[model samples]
Target: MSSPLRLILFDVDGTLADSQGAITGAMAEAFEGAGLPVPPRDAILSIVGLSLPLAMRELAPGQDAATVEALVEGYKSSYMLAREAAGAGHSPLYPGAREALAELNAIPEYLLGVATGKSQRGVEALIAAH
Candidate 1:
């Protein structure tokens, strides 16, 4: 007898891919561009699961929503520039990620899903590369 199909959701940030470099690098650039003091790496990483704007707000307190929005957009711009410069290949898969994906995909009973804090474009780019 076969079991019923089930969804297997995976988080992208640190689960499916190690995007720390692009994330932190872009965030630092954004903070500098916005003239806000950069948050520590630990602090930034702690909010990895939050949406970009919310993460920006937490990372940069005492700032109006407009500034936070600007910072978020600045972060996206910086990340995109860096990604393009690097051929958008920075978010390499973790060990065995592709193999795991393939394995899961091969199983007809499994439905793979990605849940990440990354932007839609970011996710699309990563999927395109992978």
Candidate 2:
């Protein structure tokens, strides 16, 4: 008899990878590039699960749409540059994450996937890097 499949979905940021450094760094660069005050680290982290456009709006409320769009683009470019520079080390996996994924993969009944607010390209880069 075939075993029933059990799917496991892991969050890309915070859960599988400790991406706070990259996230906060990109946020700061984006805000600064827009001539806006950079938010506190805690504030930036608070928006981790939000999509980039939504996060940008939350961070820079009351701004014109152009400013919000600029922040989003700035963040995306900054993050991409950092990822290119750092490669796999851009966002190191949390301790034991590699082992955990391997262990799960070894189980025939288990299937793993990622759920994240990141763009498809961003997720692809992360996967390719690791």
Candidate 3:
């Protein structure tokens, strides 16, 4: 017999959290630091669900492997710095974010977990802060 989707996996950015401002701001910083052009906010936000390297590649086309690696590292560093400056606050949860999570957690049959491309540390920090 097939089992139900007892586990609900949610993506972090733009899904669970309205993190467009923070992520796009950090991307701008990283691009400036790396001497790359900053993409539009929509462009930056569009790659939220992708893996780190893949996101970097998608956002920064024509980027060779090494440049992509550097961009990814730069983004991580910039994001962390921005988050710290912004008090490491919880990213703005979507409209039903808390309610949904609470509702799911309250259920005896459900388990909730995030399945985003963010680093383990980042996701852990987000959950802890939330």
Compute each candidate's TM-score over C-alphas: 0.93, 0.98, 0.85
Model 2 worst lDDT window (10 residues): 114-123
Better of 1 and 2 by TM-score: 2
Candidate 3 lDDT, 87-125, residue by residue in tens: 536377788988988988987668788877788988777
Minimal lDDT window, size 10, model 1:
83-92
Candidate 3 lDDT (Cα, 0 to 1): 0.81
TM-score, candidate number 3: 0.85
Ranking by lDDT: 2, 1, 3
What's the true lDDT of residue 91 in model 1? 76
TM value for model 2: 0.98
Best first by TM-score, ranked: 2, 1, 3
Q: Give me the runs in candidate 1 sitting further than 4 Å from their true place.
A: 1-3
Per-residue alpha-carbon lDDT of candidate 2 for residues 1-130, written as tens digits (9 for 90 to 100): 9999999999999998899999999999999999999999999999998998999999999999999999999999999999999999999999999999999999999999988898899899998998
Backbone clashes in each candidate structure, one number apiece?
A: 0, 0, 0
Which regions of candidate 2 are displaced past 4 Å?
none
What are the lDDT figures for the candidates, one per model?
A: 0.88, 0.95, 0.81
